[model samples]
Target: MNYVLALFLPPLSILLIGRPILSIVVFLIWVPAIIFSGGLTHPMFILLAWILIYQAHQDRRAR
Candidate 1:
């Protein structure tokens, strides 16, 4: 679920994990990075969002 979202919208995926501030920050960085790098740096943010989503899910399971 989140993993697929992360591929297309990393910041939004991060938002789903409950980090509003971080999501805003990621979105700010992501938009420019996408434009400036011509999407080359996108994978980095995607991996980050995916990791955050995974971690959040793991935390929920632990609770």
Candidate 2:
């Protein structure tokens, strides 16, 4: 699942760095993740993880 993680990396990077451009890049990556992993995995877990990571990034930026 390296490819799956890799897909998330760009968006994760953007989230941590607080770059809108990178965030857009992340979305691009996420699209495939959604397509490939969506039916295979638990959607709630994926969504929760994303929200948690996003919130954590935002909190870090606010600090």
Candidate 3:
């Protein structure tokens, strides 16, 4: 569910994964990057969010 959400809302996905600070940073960077770069940079943030989500899941599973 969050992985699928990451595909669309990267910052929100990051937040959902439990990284409030990082999510805020991503939100700040992502919106402007998308606006300025015409969405070219969005994929990078999406990938970052996905990686964060995966790591969070792994951590959860390990617990």
lDDT (Cα) of model 1: 0.81
Off by over 4 Å in 2: 1-41
- Clash number by candidate, in order: 0, 1, 0
Locate the minimum summed-lDDT window of 10 residues in model 1.
2-11
Between candidates 2 and 3, the one scoring higher on TM-score is 3
lDDT of 1 at 31: 74
TM-score per candidate? 0.82, 0.36, 0.82
Each prediction's Cα lDDT score? 0.81, 0.62, 0.81
**TM-score, candidate number 2:** 0.36
Residue 14, candidate 2: C-alpha displacement in angstroms: 18
Better of 2 and 3 by lDDT: 3
Clashing pairs in 2: 11-26
lDDT by residue (1-63, candidate 1, tens digit) is 853453348888888889999999988888777767777987799889889989998999999
- Greater TM-score among 1 and 2 belongs to 1
Model 3: which residue pairs collide?
Answer: none
